[model samples]
Target: MELIERIRLHAARSPDSTALEWPGGTIGYAGLAAEIERLAAELRGRGISTLAISLGNGPAWAMLDLAALHAGLCLVPLPPFFSEGQMRHALKLSGAQALVTDQAVVLRERLDLPEPMGSWRVAGRPLSWIDLPGDPQAVPAGVRKLTFTSGTTGEPKGVMLGWNHMEPVVRSLADAAGVTPSDRHLVLTPLSVLLENIAGIYTALWSGATAIVPGCPEVGLIGSSRLDTAAMTLALDRFRATSAIFSPQTLQGLVEAIESGLPRPAAFRFGAVGGAPVPPRLLERAAALELPVYEGYGLSECASVVCLNTPGHNRPGSTGRPLPHVRLRIAADGEVLIAGPGFTGYLGEEPPAGEWWASGDIGRLDPDGFLHLEGRRRNVFITTFGRNLAPEWVEGELTLEPAIAQAALFGEGRPWNTAVVVPAPGADATAVAAAIARSNLNLPDYAQVSRWIAAEGPFTPANGQLTGTGRVRRAAVQGHYQQQIERLYQ
Candidate 1:
């Protein structure tokens, strides 16, 4: 069933069941369905074809998203973490006709809009609605959602998805994770992230579960990468969240918090970890703490999650089997490929060429059919000896040690790999070296980090060294540390 259909069914079956929960209020299934209908009618009356939202995560965000879907308007979700340039690029590229945001004052100054077109209370939160000068750029007829990606470099690209591409993933995910009406899914990452929006919120709603969507600040998410584990855990406990999605970095912080005497949310289960390659050691630690994390793999072009590890079938280091909606295969060159109708293509661009979308990731299916990812196909570097290496594989091992917070290995056409290491807070050289030595134990001599330099600080979006979704921007990091790396080689 479609998302809106599922909401209507839930409202009819269990009108009083909580469908959405936030800091100040809760909306039951009946209220949620009714509210979405009203909002959809309002958007239709205003003649909105494309709607963009920059609101913080909460009931308002949820309601507006559903309203856009119901009203047949293309929804463009702009992540607040995006820079002004990126935000402007998305708004223009997607040809957004209307914008709904809580930070109206700041966005007005940055986006250079005149006074607000109007203001209204949506889902109990006061918000501003502005009319944008729609761009003439064609976004394609079938596109229903345009999600801009915080890719490795350059301006963010808008990946468009239609209802057909998204619904299967939602239903498959709900089935894979075994979501039910009793489950409460906490929205940990930004809803603009397709993974959290489709796989997290949409899946929960499809399963008739309540979605707990506190603002990023309420969950202690300072930006794209920095998180306060204590605050996040408190929210989990407060809402009694049964499920949530996380990137590897956030999961590591939560594990450290639990180790530092903060009680783990006992109700927490089905933690889906992705957005980057997860260190096996980190997964082991989380498992040791009984955190119930499952690693998955996806790309925005594939409609968020292509494959996921579920409770019934999971492998620790592998990214798991493909979900039912799509078929996955390894190309002759070892690139992962997904077969389906694919996306509606990037905004203002021609439709994607092939029937199979090249994932750019290199991985293989195990004997038992589990997909084990090595790293990005383009990211693989060749050493002077002509041996190929995937830096993410080595970096994953390095981050396994608690002393090392982030690692970027460089050895392209060089004799040996050199890592720019970001040590955890208060970790001295000795601690970092020890961590590297321990990680080297798990790698072959050819792939070991023969020499390393301490980074000034963690690789983050602010520094242009990390993507919004936590993937390391290898080129940016190498450029920043070129001189130091050369010194180590000399």
Candidate 2:
């Protein structure tokens, strides 16, 4: 319970249903529980406590994130692709005493923040308020959602969590994706991360459904690693979206716009891809274009789904099985641990020293329990003839070759493996060297690659080489291709 008592139990059992949708209106569930108890009573009459929500995906950023969990305050969520020194190191390491933005003169001329300590109009937009001088700190008594960590491979830590560790992972992801109220979901990413704010608006308002939220250019999300796919397939056919959530590069541009003919949304049912590592030939070309997608797995220290692949229980390359309140294990050097009830520690660090949660991700599980993963134990590497590999398993088999739109790999001690690629758009260089010789004939021979080059661009998140949840910030793409990876190792 308590996602503000499940939005006042869906405003006492569906008060006029709808519960949020955007491009200018639709609020219901008793006007989203009276605009989250009137902006959590105008943020507990301005004493605020910790707030921070930098706004973007509409409906007043889901009514001030459930009115900062109904005004017990503490929120944080900034991430509009961070970087103004990670939003002034997350408003001075989360000491944030009040921010609630909507750009506000580009965060008051880039983080000088201060001025207006008042302004609001809630769901009809506007917003403002600054305050922020500091001296708040002390957050760790069931800290209610601090978030942060999408810094790809650098600074962005925070984590925290609470609401009894994120309402049992949003009631085990609405009972492993069977979420109903006829699931209209569709806020494809950025409700300030935490996997689209607890698996896309707390599992679409814990199954009373209808989330939608718009803006990120009405779902084509232009910035952090571009995406348009015909304005995200006309915002999933103008919100006929029956469930959404993606990031395996926007489910590889909506499975290459449903293999070029574009037109998947016949009330789309369940999408859910994950933040990274999803290439079983892009889930076999999104199941040969039937495009139901699936593929899940998480981290934000487990509060955002801890394994999923739903819809008649999927498994096309694992990362499913484990959501019934999560518990998965594996260690014995294969890492991926995770013991249940959603993790609850990490703002200034210290708290997780055991009872599983090691998850520096490297996976296994199987024997019908699914899971799989296999990468990021500090991204493996080690070659100089000793072998070892796992550059996301050779860049997920060189992006399952639709003329490889990205690949990174590099051999940590050298002796064979190179890559940089990027292609896919009139591809060439003989179709990216024949898709790296058909991805080195299915890798091995010390994780193959041998030599490659092509990428003088496209590894995005505005060029820090990806990671506003698109992953590959591999030391900023090996320091922006250190002289074409030292001329492919001379």
Candidate 3:
């Protein structure tokens, strides 16, 4: 069944219970339903048979999403930080009837964000269900939510999921993550894609938990971009958030709160981190805050998480076992192959014969069955001496130092490993190089970053330093920094 129908069921079951909460906000099941209906009514009338819904992690974003699906329009969710070129490409390919966005890139390119509302506040406005007309025509059977892979290698590939394909993944994730009706979850991802969509909101509600989308003050220095980390602490304290799935970047903020002797979320129990390989130090720091943070592993193809550590089975470096009804196996080449309730296939690509997706990730199963993500398949580089190196391994190690924000390693068909790195603002490049030199001492001689050069500036989505989901785009960085990397060899 669609998430809207499930929401209807819950609203009927618990109309008076709090269904959503954010800092300075709260909504009951009945209130949530009414708002969704109003949102559906408003958009379906505006020739929005298919909506390209653009929203950051927030209440209004969730409300619009559920409402759009309930209103019978196919929805395409955009990652929040897509550059103008990327957004335009995705919007055009999505065949969207209308666009919705708060992304500055969208506005700078004039994608008609504010729409007929004549204001950027429509996403946050409170309109009653009574304000909307009766629901419009329902969506067709193939109607779906479109999620574009972050274009890490090249152009983005849209992954479409029929209403039939998504429900089971939501239930499985909620079960695996151990969310319950008493739990209040702070949504820490943008709403424009399936990764955060199913894992964040749908799964939270499936478990009867409350999900909050922090209200952004306005687009400014102190807006959502800064994220109300301090305010999040207050909300967690007040709402008693028990469980959350977060990007590692947000986990870093929570680490600060813990170090400062601030009150930890009392009900906060289980948390998971994704979007990158988290350092053991980060996880250890999170534990210091009394937050049990597990590193999650998945891609848009896996519908968010194929594996994650839950309450009782916490393991460092491993993204727990697969959820129930999900099947995982290792291919001969070490690729993590999956057959499960998640990710049927890509939009244009033919479904694999067995309904299995070979996660481009190369990983292995420990004897205990927990999975460890090794690195990307394309990342394997053979040095001039035929030494195969996974640059991701070296890079993951280098970025752990607070002074370094980005690192790319290259030695493919070359004499030795060379690195081009971006230092954190105001960091000493010379000292960082010394640290790198020191750190590499522990690594095998062949795998070590034998030489290094400093990057001129941070890598960006525009220039391909980061994927829309915020994971460092390795290929782009390597390509952009080829000259600097070569200089190390010289």
Candidate 4:
């Protein structure tokens, strides 16, 4: 069944059941369905063929997204973490005719947008609607969602997907996570993220589960890199969240908070960690704290989730088995291959000719069928001595140290590796050096960092050194610290 149809069915079957919850309010299934219907009708009446939205995690964002999906208007979700240039590129690439955003001030200042075309209020939050001046660009047929990829270059690529691509993933996630009306899923990340949008929100709606979607600030998310785990834990406890998702960075913060004596929320039943490789040590720490986090793997091309670890079957170091809907294989060269129904191709790009999509990720299925990822195929670097290593492999080990927060390894055809290290808060230079020594003990001499320099600050999207999803932009990072890195080599 279509997600919207399932939502309507839930409304018909259980009108009074809560479907969405926020800081100051709660909406029942019937109320949510009615609101989506009303907004969808208004959008259709306005002759809107394409819609874009930039809002925080809240009922307003949720309703706008559902309404666009129900009205069959193509939806473009502009991520808040995107720079103005990337945002403009997405708007132009998708040819969004209208944009509704809560952060109108940012848009006005950044994009030089004209006066608002009108105002809209949904679920008690007021929003501004701006009519953009672009014709609808041609996209592949059945493209309903235009999601931008966090490309290494400054410009992000637009990934086009249809309902057929999204719904199966939603159902797979719902079944994998065992989502039910009793599960109060917490929105820990931005709603614009495909992971959170499809796996978190859409899956929650499909299963008739209540979603607690507070603004980013309420969930302790600040900008792209900073997280207040204490505040996040409080929110989880306050909402009694039964499920949520996190990037590895956020999960690290939560684990540290628990170790610092913050009471762990006992209501959590399912917590998924993804977007980048989860350091196995971090998972071990979380498990030691009784935190129920499952490691998963996916890409935007797969419509968010391809494989996920669940309570029923999980491996701490491996991304769980592939979901029932998708087939996974390891090529002879070790690239992960995915064959699924949902991928429509990129905007203004040719459709994939092959039955399988090369994920660009190198991985292998263990004897138990769990997927174990190494790193990006193109990111593998060879040392001057002919030793090949993936930076992520070394970086992951470095970050396992409590004193080191982020590490970017760079050593292509160089005698030794050098890293730009961002120290954890309150960690001193001596402490960081000691942590590096400890990390180096775990790595081979070829991949070990021989010298390192302190970074100016934590890599972030604003600084163009980190992707919105929290993965470091390696090329950008290396370029930004070129002189310092050269000094280390000398």
| C-alpha TM-scores of all predictions | 0.97, 0.35, 0.87, 0.98
Tens digits of per-residue lDDT for model 1, 1-490:
5688999999999999999988889999999999999999998999868889999888899899998898888999998778788888888888888889998999999879768877889977899988888863457776788999888878888999999999988988989999999999999988988999998888998888999999898987987667898998788878899999989888888888888999889898789999999989889998999888999999899899988898899899999899988998899999998997578888767778877888999999999889999899989999999999999989989987889989999999999999999998889999999999999999999999999999998898767788878999999999999999999888
lDDT of 4: 0.89
Candidate number with the higher TM-score (2 or 3) = 3
- Which portions of model 4 show Cα errors greater than 4 Å? none
Model 2, 115-176: lDDT tens per residue? Answer: 87667878777888878776565575557778888665777888888777788888888887
Q: Return the top candidate by TM-score.
A: 4
Please report how far candidate 2 places residue 338 from its true position, in Å. 38
lDDT, candidate 1, equals 0.89
Give the candidate order by descending TM-score.
Answer: 4, 1, 3, 2
lDDT sort, best first: 4, 1, 2, 3
Which prediction has more favorable TM-score, 3 or 4? 4
**RMSD (Å) of each candidate, 1 decimal:** 1.5, 20.2, 4.4, 1.2
User: Candidate 4, residues 231-266: lDDT per residue as tens digits?
Assistant: 998888889999999999889888988899988998
Compute the lDDT of residue 65 as modeled in candidate 3.
79
Worst 10 residues of 1 by lDDT: 135-144
Residues 74-171, candidate 3: write the lDDT tens digits.
77776656666677777666666565655545463454433234343444553221111212232234656777887568888877666666776787
